[model samples]
Target chain A: MAVLTFLLRFLPFLLFGRKERPSPVLDSLNKLLPSAIIAVLVVYCLKDMNFRRIDNFVPELIAVAVVALLHLWRRNNLISIGGGAVVYMLLVQLVF
Target chain B: MKAELRYAVRQTLPVMIGYLFFGTAFGLMLQNIGYNFLWAMLASLVIYAGSMQFVLVSLLAGAFNLPAVILMTLTINSRHFFYGLPFLKKFREMGKAYLYMVFSLTDETYALLCSVWIPDHLDGKKVRFFIALFNHLYWITGSTLGALGGALLNIDLKGIEFTMTALFIVIFIEQWISATKITRVPAVVGLLCGLVLRLILGPDRFILPALIVTVTILLVLRPSLDRRSGEKEEEGSSVPSKR
Candidate 1:
């Protein structure tokens, strides 16, 4: 299983490394893919979201809103993360 | 080299916190499932991918089907393939250091590599290597500690995993705001595609399909986006400042 995992990771380098330069298409995709992937990761993080229950839904909503707004205000990754997490912990533990 | 190591440590500090909690959770889960710290350490060292490692604990305790494990591993880690694309040139340039980079390109490590700026005098190659190595070590330490005494920590960790989620949301917002030179099409397309897929496929199966969808959309729209943002590239807006 470990070997398979390693191979899946290594395959891209193997395919693109030993050859001609990456096509312009690949270059454009490379430039554009990071943000897209970051978005995917955000959705991935919220994957378990169950909105059917108000109690379960409110904390996640509040925490995410806190993260987005805090980041927009300060543009500091640390503050947004730390503050949002604290709010989330509090909500889940005490409020909900 | 000392300076480079310090920078690497600084870059990896947030990861240390996230991994410590997430990995400790992994260790705690393993212990709950009757595995020792030794197994936790080995998995963290070998399997390495955080989400997959958590899933592996359940797999290990339940079954011994090698084929099933391999298939599951591939599906869970398919996002890793795209992580290598942006690093293709750097990996080739790093020569011997390339293998370690490949081994350590987890999601958080890749985010750091993609966005963090190496200091002017420091070696970019070495900084990248150390960041990867340091993050890997943090993960290993977290899992080992969690396995060793996770139950004794006695803190409610239910929502602590939000650290990772908050971290990513913060990065996404930063990218959205920072990528002024490029059209924001990619970010919007990615966000929408992810949401649609998550709704259609659910979270467990949406990632790979979302990746494919995003790539296809970008490829089809690249020419127009290039035309729109192409002029800004020479203005140095293409390179957003370090986060």
Candidate 2:
């Protein structure tokens, strides 16, 4: 499993060497992909969102808002994440 | 060298926070499933991918089929292949540290390494090396600690996984804000495509297909997108290239 994980991570580097620049198309894709991937990942994290229960919705919204607003306000990764997670834990444990 | 290592350690502080929680969760889960601390440490050291390691707990509990395990590993880690694209040049120049970089390229480390700024006095290679090394150590230490004492700690951690989610949300916002108009296209497309696929295919099956569709959309939109964003490409470089 480890070897497989390493190979998957290392394949692109192995395929594209240091001496050569990737083609123009790939170069463009390289720039484009990070934003796309990160966006997709956000959705991936929220993939299990359950909309049937209005009760379940409030905490998620509040937690996500806390995370976004805290990040915007502080721009400190730790503050934003730690704040969000604490609020989320409190909500899920006590309120919701 | 000490200063550079300190800088690396400081930069990885957020990841250290996330990894400890994540690794502890993994350790506790593995312990629940009848694994020992040695097993958790082994998995953390070897199959160090965070999400995949979590998935691995269940896989280990299930019937051991090698082919099934290999396929599962590939699918879970397919996103990693794209990560190395931006780092290809830099990794190739890292001397002996190149292999370690490749070996430890977890999601959090990749984000940190991508955005790391090397001071003029510090060696860039060493900074990157230490960042990767420190994050790796944190992960191993967290999992080992969790395995050794997770049951004793025994606090409710229901929504703690939100740490990872929150991290991703911040990263997405950063990308969205920094992205150029044309560059934002892919980000929007990814979110829309992923949502639609998730609705249609349901959550579990959406990711791979969503990724494929997003890439295809980007390819089709490349010419116009490139023309619009062309000038800013050099200015707003996505990944810091080899210097």
Candidate 3:
């Protein structure tokens, strides 16, 4: 799962990761391999997703949402995340 | 080399606290469910998802049939697709280690690696590899320990799964602090979708759908968001002036 995820996350940078002025080693790898791995990952993700009835897991969902809002307001700062985490921790433990 | 590894470990210390305890719980849960260290390690290393590991304990115990496992895997991991999309190139040339590196990529590690300072003086991929390696170790080690604890004691792990929520919050905080409007946009979408999805799809299926929705929204806005994130990354990664 993580491997597929790595490929999925990293591959699209193929088009966008390129810089007119490139970092040779990094640039070459970016051009060549990311795509192959991404293909494999896509298969993996699809395979797992193809079947099954999904359930609702609320606490984490809410946490993701709150964090997203906080990210917008605070710009991914750790302190702000701290606030977000504290809220999530409380909510998950207490509310839902 | 060891010193660099040490530094990496130190940097991940705060996260370690959460990983360690959560790992212990996960380990214990799986152990109680008839899994051992090998199983624990495989789950942590292969799946590499903290929440999934705990949920997997039940799944592995035959809690659900094949269909349930499939649905759960997809739903739990949907967000990862986009997370990896941006870093594909880096993982490609990572050589033999690339496979292992990819196997261990998690939301926390990805966020940390994405924002890491690309050292001007040395091998960037190697540096990134170490970062990935470092986080992986934390997880691998944490899982081994968790399984050990579960083996020793008997307790219902259903409630303990909440650790993942806390962990996500921590990761969310870490990203939120360093993120900008562009990065935050996906997160915001995750939030809104997560909320609505939770209500509609319920908690279990919310993440994947929310991820799809968020990614689509981000894709639509990519040009503008990329322009913004690119600017921020420039400002964020540039060297500070030496006094």
Candidate 4:
């Protein structure tokens, strides 16, 4: 697992290390892919939700909503994540 | 060097807090699953990727399946492949520390490196190295402490895993808020692809397919995207300095 993870990190440099300039296609990807991949990660984190049950999904939805709204208001990482996680813990521990 | 170190520390303070909490949570989880502090230290020291390390805990607890481990590592850490792209030229300039730089480019470190403003008097490379090193040290310390805490102090943290999800959402919002016109396309593409694939393929198998599809679509749309961004570059608004 460690070797594979390192190899993935090393792959880009190995491919483009010697090139004087990356191709237009590669450059475009460099410019565009970061935000896209990050958005995908957000979705990936929520993949296990079984929407058929309200209890299983409601807490997550409320928590995510809190994270988003708090982030938008304060624009602070610590506040957004910390606030959302606390709300989640409360909901899971007591409400649902 | 002193000035650079001080600046790096100040810049990485937020990451320090985040890593400490997140790492402790990871340590607590691993310990709960019967792994000792040694394992937590080793994983944090080597893997260095926060989310992947969490996944690693589960993998280690389960019956060892090499193929499953390989695939999970590839997909989970694949984002690191892109993280290195913008830094390739800069990292290459760092000489022997280049390998270490690549290995330590976790999401928080990458974001800091991309967005932080180094002072004009300080060497950018040195500051970057310090930032990376400090972040890694915090993670190692946090996880080791968490593992020890788990062994010594029993506490209920039932919903603590939600931190991982919350972190991702924070990152997604950061990216979205900072995205320019040309970059917004891929963000939308990723979300739609991820959601569609998740609904169709189910959660367990959706990520890889979503990534492949997103990449293919982006590649096909590259020309127009390139042209749009090029125009923005001409207007001198290319890179937005984000915090």
Candidate 5:
């Protein structure tokens, strides 16, 4: 597992690091992929939920909405994440 | 060096909080599954990838299947392959620290390195190295403490895993707020690809396909994206071109 994980992380550096200039496609990816990948990751994190069930979905939806709104309002990472997680915990523990 | 470390600490404060909570949860989970602190430390030391480590606890608990383990590791961590792209040149410039940077580039660490700013007076390489190192240290400490304290500590953390989700959401919003017209295209592409593929393939099988489709779409759209970015640069917009 360790070897494979290292190899995956190392592959791009090994392929591109030594090049004087990488292909323009890669350069474009460097710009484009981060935002895209981050978006994918947000979905990935939520992927396993059984959204058909209200108990499973509502708290997550509300918490995620809280995170988005808090982040937009404050633009503070910690506040948004911490606030959302707290809301999630409370919803699961108390309300939902 | 001291100033760089200080800046790295401040910059990584959010990650520090998140990792400690998240890592401790992982450690507790592993301990519940009968792994000791040594195992937790070792996993955090080598495997280092956050979500995959959680997946590993299940893999270890179940019947040991090498093929399953290998496949899971590759699939879960495959997103890492793209992470090195932006840092390839900058990390190579860091000499001996390059490998460490690559090894420690977990999702949060990579996001921090990409988004944070270093002071003009500070050595960007050293600051980046410290950021990577500090995040790694936080994970190790959190997991180790969790493993060691698992039996004694019995707080309800049922929904705390949402922290990871919340963190990613915050990052997505950050990127959205900062993204230019062309940059936003890939994000929408990724979200749509991920959503559509998740619907088609279900959750377990969507990530790799979403990534491939997103990349292909981006490539097909690259000429237009590149041209627009070039025009933006010519207009002297503050957005830094990736190259």
Candidate 6:
């Protein structure tokens, strides 16, 4: 799977972009294989998306949003990702 | 350092936004399923891939079988099949962490990898390395927080799994807009294959098959793609090459 992912991710560069690959066959193939196997796995997940699942999925969405905003504010300091996660925990877990 | 970091962050801003939503959604959903913050954190930090982690929660909640888990993991992460193929040597040069880096690789990070043109300049290496590291760190943090979110807020999460889909669309748009020439073929192939696989394999098992078909075709046709690209490069540059 990872082998497939490696190929998919790097194929663009192999096909269209510039970068002299030492071994396009082995390197590119090995790089993207993960995503391919992942593609198969996640599809099953889409089928079972019920209210129960969605309800749980909500807070995660909120957390992700907070992190994103923090990244923008911090201009990608990465500290924001950490801080935002913690803040999200407090708001969701403690405050409310 | 300040300027570079800013640009680095700016470069990652879109992904950060994407990751936040999905990561948080993942946390909430997983926690809702029955795992605690520790489990969630472990998955996020170790497994690190958003889609797979989300699916994993359900697996853990229900029947955490080894075969199923292995298969599901493979299917969900099939997108990684070819990520480093062309850049194997580059990654190989990355030394020991190469395997771990590959382990941590996710779709969003992959998207970032696609956009950034790693130049041959002196600072280029640092920039590319940081780019990969920063993206990984962001995801880890997001996942840990999400696990925390699940632990703390026992509320209804509601429609958050859409986070992954939403992010996919955003990256799709960015790549679609920026792409020119040689990119069109794979895009069309991937889409058509994905759609077809969805129909044949049904929604629950389409992504992996689609990826399989796409990769096989690409590999077989690699020489042709390479040739066409070489011709195009000839028209644009005055460089001599020997690979």
The TM-score values for the models, in the order shown, are 0.93, 0.89, 0.61, 0.81, 0.91, 0.62
Docking class of 3: incorrect
Better by DockQ, candidate 5 or 2: 5
Residue A72, model 1: lDDT of 85
Q: Which stretches of candidate 2 lie over 4 Å from their true place?
A: B117-122, B231-243
Regions of candidate 6 where Cα sits further than 4 Å from its true position:
A1-96, B118-122, B150-183, B232-243
The candidate with the higher DockQ, 2 or 4, is 2
All candidates' lDDT scores?
Answer: 0.87, 0.83, 0.56, 0.84, 0.87, 0.56
Model 5: how far is A49 from its true place, Å?
3.1
Q: Which lDDT tens digits does candidate 3 get at residues B69-130? A: 66666666656655555465566677697666656667666555654555455566766777
What are the per-model DockQ values? 0.80, 0.75, 0.13, 0.63, 0.79, 0.10
Q: Write the per-residue lDDT of candidate 3 for residues A18-83, one digit (tens) a residue.
A: 554555443333222222222222222222221133323354455456656766676544444455
Candidate 5's docking class is medium
Looking at candidate 3, what is the lDDT of residue B196? 56
Chain B TM-score against the true chain B, each candidate: 0.91, 0.85, 0.72, 0.75, 0.89, 0.76
True contacts kept of each: 0.78, 0.83, 0.16, 0.77, 0.85, 0.08
Model 3: lDDT equals: 0.56
Distance from true location, Cα of A28 in model 2, Å? 1.8
Q: For model 2, state the Cα shift of residue B88 in Å.
A: 1.2
lDDT of candidate 6 over B1-243, digit per residue (tens) = 555565567667656755666676677677677666676666666666766677777777886587787777666665565455444555556666565555545665655555564444335445556666777676666666776763565654434334344334334444445555664556655666665677677656666567768788767766676677667778667655533
lDDT string for model 2 (B1-243, tens) is 999989998788777877888888788889888998899999999889998898888888898888888888888788788778777778888888888899899877877776666889998899999999998988998898888898788688888878877877888777777766777898899899988988999877788888889889988999989887765676558644634
lDDT tens readout by residue for model 4, A1-96: 778778888888998987988776777787777777777777887888888988789999999999999999998877888899899999989898
* A41: Cα error in model 3, Å: 20
Sort the candidates on TM-score, descending order. 1, 5, 2, 4, 6, 3
User: By DockQ thresholds, what CAPRI class is model 2?
Assistant: medium
